[model samples]
Target chain A: MAAVKLLNCFVSPFGNRVRIALAKKGVEYEETAENMVTKGPLLLSSNPVHAKVPVLLVDGKAVCESLVILEFIDEAFAGTGAQLLPADAYARANARFWAAYVDAKMPECAGKIWKVPKGAPAVEEGKKEMVGVFKTLEGELGEKPYFGGEALGYADVALVTFTPWFLTYERLAGFSIAEECPKLTAWAARCVGENECVAKSLPDAEAVYQFVGGMRKHFGLE
Target chain B: MAAVKLLNCFVSPFGNRVRIALAKKGVEYEETAENMVTKGPLLLSSNPVHAKVPVLLVDGKAVCESLVILEFIDEAFAGTGAQLLPADAYARANARFWAAYVDAKMPECAGKIWKVPKGAPAVEEGKKEMVGVFKTLEGELGEKPYFGGEALGYADVALVTFTPWFLTYERLAGFSIAEECPKLTAWAARCVGENECVAKSLPDAEAVYQFVGGMRKHFGLE
Candidate 1:
């Protein structure tokens, strides 16, 4: 068997995603957590294009990008514990579409959600944008228990990691996600509460919010 | 056999990418050219999430996003023609990584590579960023005849469409891409010069430059 390893940051949503993917697939691998503040040589060398984690190494062949890594896990471990993506071609495309959405919208929303210093940009626009994105997601998730129908598949796996940031996402954006997207909120709760892999893989949302708060203060935003 | 159709814009790099992928795959499809400025109802209804062109309809099932469309073509039309993606798992992941890079970087670079009035954001930073992106790409290309090693594949399809905008990319950025990255420039020339699919699909660079000049004038950027 090829030795599998993961280079990651404990708090990174992308990194945690790789964790959830591997845990969900029941792929056993060694973990090397990097200091995201000053990314180590291995992470930098492994992913020179982006120079960010999480990177998965299968027998030291590095694969970067969370979405790419997720696809890699599905392909590399074809007959593992569970298949992450759906079997139907159209459903796979739909899954890819939402996965792309999560990557594109989540980070920018998270970055803009922080309370910044005066003279810095106002957060209202960011808040409004986040609300719109969530609503769109809600519309897509309409009446389905999960984005992948009945199972927590690729689309679900792609997004569920963001629950740890939902508190910060809502608080800094000055809105309640549940009020705007109750089904999505409930879906999020269910993913973390009902799914053991997601539950164990995700960090606490409150802790993440507090950590971000401290960073804001350190940068003199508070 | 499923009916295939492509919704596209003549000058869009992404739209052209879908065209190239299909041509390379030898998959015959009818085309509906959309007015990019006033996108029609079909485009809107087909891709509500993005509402962009290059939506491939295989038997009326809409698949949006150029990369997603490309993958759909490879899977849905497997064994019909040349496979655009490599057979190897790692190679497929690498192709996807660069495809993502082209999508993430090219549009921003092209948008910022326009001559704008003062107090409008400066173009220098965008130019520098584009140069860096090009250099990274050049290094990746190395001595390969194409990004796919010997043929025009996914990564090639992803980026080669940008050639029509190359003159404009160089013109506004105030750097000759040929001078900055000769191998990449030569590779670009070779792809369009040698590949029938790429050659027929791409618009003329000089004409695109002149058309963009008219648009700039319309926007009163002069």
Candidate 2:
């Protein structure tokens, strides 16, 4: 068997998706931590366009983008572990829909809170936007145990990866994902707590907050 | 075999993608063209969130999003036509990377031209932004015959889908994709002229320009 290797760092929601997927699939792989700050050569060469981490290097080949990696893993390891998606077409498409939604809309919304600069106009705007997204997510969650309504499918994987970040943002930004979105928040907590892969994969919430807090400075926020 | 049905509108580049894929694959299917100006139950039910067209209803199950539809079709058909993606993992990732880039980045560039108001401020700003993106694309294209190089691949499909709109913009907006981006414009022409599927999939260029001219009234550009 060609040895599997993952180029990632600690607590990357994007990377965590792959990490948890690997663990769930029972695929043993070596994890190489790449510093996201400087974004060393290997990371650059692997993903020239995005230059981001959580790159899955199978043998020597690298795959970029979290969602793409998720799909690749599911297809490549079809028989390995719990299927990441449904065998039915509509179910799979629905999962992909939510996954795309999480990647495109929700993450950007949640990202605003993390990027809020003290006293900046964007801060207030970001807060407003975050709440709006949270409400939408809450409405979507409604009373479902998971996004797919029973199984921890791709939608759950996408949403779960962000929960750690959301927890950190709720505290560091002095806002509340749970206060405004109790069901969604509760669901997130439940998902994380129930899954050993998730619980063990995430770092302490404060560490994530501080890590992102430094990122704000690097991006020249405020 | 599950019956294939497509819900689309004439002008959406997204819809065109599915059309081209179907034509290339020699897969015959029933198509329902929706008038996007007026809402339809089929469109509404198929894609409630975006309520957009290019929804591929495979055996009555809706698969929204052009790229996702393409993937579904590729997987569903399996053995027919030119493969939309490469078989090798890294190569497939690169193709998907470019596809995502076109969907994400190219649109803002194309939108600058397509959505440009007739007035000077909007036109100038649009031209500047459009040219900026063109420059990036041109540099990326370098000396390649297509975005994915010699053989037409996913990136080519992406660029070709939107070329009709660019052609219209060049004529109506008093700008030229060719002048700003010789390589990209040449590539676009090559794609449309070279591939019978691409050519057949697009409405006449002048017809699209006339259509754009009509849209001015709706957008208040008139």
Candidate 3:
């Protein structure tokens, strides 16, 4: 077997996505925690273009980007635990569709709920935008137990990865995602409660909220 | 064999990307030209999240997003004429890195070069911003004959997809990419001249320039 290793930071939701995948797949691997604050030379050499983390090194080959890393992990460990994706072509495309949707749209919405200054115009606009996004997810869920149906597939993993951020943002923005998106809210709660892999990988809700709060203070927005 | 269908528009660079990919792979598919001004129900229902076109439907299943569809085509038809990506994990990640970089950065740069009002402050700022992005691409390219080196890959495809727009922008903006980033300019020339798929897929230089002129007039900026 090729030696598997993961380089990550604790706070990045993208990093957390890969960590959960590793744990969910029951794949044993070495890990190196990178200090994103002052990224080192080795890190720069490994990923020259972006130089960001959540880099998965498999047998000395480095793969950057969380979505790409997730695909690599699924392909590398084909028959481990639960199948991260469906085997069917169209089903796999739909799973990827949601994953891309989350990566492209939801993350930006989460950013709005996080970094925007309190009472800033962006904050209000972001709030409206995020609400709209959450409502769409609610419609997609539409009483289904999960985004990709009963079993938690790739889409669930993508959404669940960032759902924790909602709690943090809710405290800061003085609003709740649950109140706006009930089906999505219930689905998120179920994910946190049931997925041990995801549960272990996430930081405490209060800790995350405090972290965002500290960031706001540092930027003189609080 | 599954039926392959592409829903696209004539001047949309994104839609052109999928068309290029399909042609490069030597896969036959039916084409449906969509009107972006007033999107129809087929385009809307096919991609409800972002009712955009350039959707590739394989066996009646819609795969939206040009890059995502490109990956699907590569994966589904692995042994076709040209592999859109590298098979190795690291190489594939690198390919994806540049593709993402182009997707994130190019539109803004192109917008500045095309959409910015002729004499506005924003136009001047857009020009500066475009020069900066080009310099970055030039530095990355260095002395490599191609972005992917040896053969054209996803990174090359990403840039090549926008080749028509670059020329159009040059004419409309009254500036030349060749002067700003000589290497990238030369790289593009090599791409369009040598690559059969790209050469056949793109419209002539004058046609693209006219397209940009039409877009500018449509937006009341020209």
Using TM-score, give the best candidate's number: 1
lDDT of 2 by residue, B101-173 (tens): 7777666755666676665465666667777766766776889887767767776786677777776667645
> Of the pair 1 and 2, which is ahead by DockQ?
1
lDDT of 1 by residue, A65-176 (tens): 9998998888888887788888887888899999999888877766676756533465777777777888898899999988988878888988888878888867776678
* Candidate 2: true interface contacts recovered: 0.29
In order, candidate lDDTs are 0.85, 0.77, 0.79
Instruction: Judging by lDDT against the true structure, name the best candidate.
Output: 1
Which structure is stronger by TM-score: 2 or 3?
Answer: 3
Question: What does DockQ give for each predicted structure?
Answer: 0.84, 0.44, 0.53
lDDT of 3: 0.79
Among incorrect, acceptable, medium and high, the docking class of model 2 is acceptable
**Regions of model 3 farther than 4 Å from truth:** A1-5, A29-38, A79-81, B138-145
Tens digits of per-residue lDDT for model 2, A21-119 = 888788889988887678878889887767888888887788888888888888787788988888776677778777877777766766666666655
Task: Give the CAPRI class of candidate 3.
Answer: medium
Residue pairs clashing, model 1: none
User: How do the residues B1-222 of candidate 1 rate in per-residue lDDT, one tens digit apiece?
Assistant: 779889998888999999888888787889999966688898999998888998988888899988988888888788889898888889999999999999889888777777564225567777778888888999999989999999888999999999888888777767788888888889899998898889888988888888788778877886
